[model samples]
Target: MSYDNNSAATPGYFNANRTATVTVNEHNFNAAEVNAQITAALQGSGVAAPGLGGWSTNGDVHTASVTFSADADYTFDVDYTDLAGNAAADYTQDKFTVDKTDPEVEFFDIEDKSANNGTVAPGVKYSDVNYMESGVDITIKGAKHDKTELSGNRTNIANGESIKMEDFKHDEETDDVYTMTAVIKDKAGNETEKEVMFSVNRFGSNYIFSETTEKFLDDVYANKPKDLVVTEVNVDSLVFNGISYGLDGTKKELKAGSDYTVKQSGGEGSWKEYTYTIKKENFEKEGRYSVTIDSEDKATNKMNNKVKECNIDFVIDKTPPTVVITGIEESSYRADEREMTINLSDNTAVKCVDVIIDGKSVATYAQKEIEKAGGKISYMIEGASEPQKIEAAALDMAGNETTSEMHKVLVTSSVWIQYINNTPLLIGSILGIVLVAGGLIWFFVIRKKKEESK
Candidate 1:
């Protein structure tokens, strides 16, 4: 019963027992950005805390997320405490990898043009489109065009680092500019597409050549011997891939064997250029003419783009030139002295004019021969005159010649005609002069008589 008070505190020397201890936040996990998952291993230790964005964790477990700060590796830090702020560590530095950019597909070479991109097999309408990368395919489609362009997702292109896509049509349909789109894809289902348009230029660049027209006259004279070829044929009726290309003023250069089927009959493909021949429209001389040159071919596009005609138009002038003489008439006598005016002109140009008097080139008429052939000729009477005949001979650049169309003028000198026109005026002037002299003399005589009477 004694020792009831013996339950006192244990004395100094023998008291030793652990009350508190230190621990760390430990967590570990791996992740990828593709799964859209945020990973955490905070259970049994650290509190799951959010990392660099797009990551969130409750006090217990981590949640999954499609959102992330960026497509790059990331780390999630988990912190822990034993009871208070005693111990802590980055529980998990989980690594996450991401890839976001689309793969690039290269097609044409920047250098070494003319190298085959691929379509170089016989009867193939296309050429090469070489590539320098892996995991890419080209599928061409002209959804807006005919079936020939609808290449349903072509994947059979020969595979290589230098992959080639052959057999792309080289010729454009008549009057139509076509578009071809290539859809490129890779192993991961990534895709890209590019479209190219081929313009219709089948008849060639040098299509039409002609002359100047001045409203009233189409100067076929400008083309001279060669002539202009003009005719209408429907160039748009060309059919390719079972579709007709309607006319729209398109001139495509011949792709020859690339566009049309080759045949052995009638001159090795009917696209022979019309051989130009020089012909004169001279039998009838002066007239308007529309000359033509045509070659037939069911296969090739015509020279001027139409299937019906390739022609030329020109005119040849062979009309005789005329000379005009103005001054005197046949057997006329004129009191006045004047020169005869001559004018010679032609459609081309006047070459020379000749003056023949009594069938001889007279020196008295300095214009016995004029290169321009017509201007004016002076006449002078030096002796008792006899009737003289005058005529003009004119020639033109086209070698056509004609004398003055009017009857020749016969000129003669006349003294009687000169007197009647001048003699009466001369006699009146002498009588006026004598009357004035008589009045002055009479005035002087009267002055002397007045002085004598004074």
Candidate 2:
């Protein structure tokens, strides 16, 4: 006779309802005397004999079994004897344990985190999403078990090594938040899992804010200071936007000290501010310019200023507008008011136009008026006997001014001179009549004297 039950328990582990049994296979005459002794015991509850009712027979086989019903470590033993009084080796099993418990896991306290502007939820560290851009250092701790596994956005994370903030950055288009799960398991197949969530901020458009109104500024004017600022915190390295192309088709980046200058404050874990002033030499000529500032946060995250707000685009209009005075002749005499048209043009839009006579501004037209009139302004200069130095001036948004060539006009504004110049046909006809009248009188006198003498 031998133990016949096949227990599914692991070598030294057990679950509910496991059984142990014994079987006898003999065709002897005295089968009624065949019997087996069985002893089963739970760890804390001393040993006891199982209720193994006399064996049941089927053909030449007899079998008996006992089932375990409680949760605990158990030990079992069995001794078998044949019908003819032949003894068999005893079978014994030890330390089959039943367990139903879970493990615990957690992350270590994160340090070296930047200042956060956002509020934190309970049990969540590094509260602000922007803080990740500057990068934080973290690791795992407080996990006790046979084996630990990690899953989610990040897995197979080194147990004690520093984890960079970039590791937690997920695809912003799909999900801006990142979650990681840590699972800890015990040798008895019991396990527990905990989740850690992180927020991330990726590259996007930036904005230029107005200090006075705290609103966005769409245009940059030359009258304003050439200051560029950033809102990101904890900036480490900065790269200004300026380039020069070589004859060999290669380009070189502009230098900070030579090409531009920078002033920075409040960073390395706090709100950061940067002011870049482009040198005047770079804008010696007048035109529109595009500039960019590319940089990296403390975590080595790239912050490119290629987007609208972050990029710099403005007119560097150092060149003045052109001015022309029409409908007036230089040094011409006029006894009546002469209407002159002032034409203005510039690379950019003209800001204003001024009509000046002698040394004072006679009239001024604003940008709107100039634009409404299509960059032309009509004005009449009062007639005067004395010559007048007239000039038309144009200005652009950059405060650049241009004055037209001085025109000395209305040199002789006398009414008689003006009449003589305009009524030439009438004067000629009157002079012809006087000459004919005098010649006719002289000829008649000559004829009368000749006839009398004859």
Candidate 2 lDDT over 262-283, as tens digits, reads: 6665534433445555554654
TM-score of each: 0.26, 0.40
Per the 3 Å backbone cut-off, how many clashing residue pairs does candidate 2 have?
0
Model 2 worst lDDT window (10 residues): 124-133
After superposition, which runs of candidate 1 have C-alpha atoms over 4 Å from their true positions? 1-273, 276-285, 294-300, 304-314, 317-319, 332-337, 343-352, 355-387, 405-454
Number of clashes in model 1?
Answer: 22
State in Å the error of residue 196, model 2: 25
Best by lDDT: 2
Poorly placed runs, candidate 2 (over 4 Å): 1-252, 256-280, 296-302, 306-308, 331-336, 382-387, 411-454
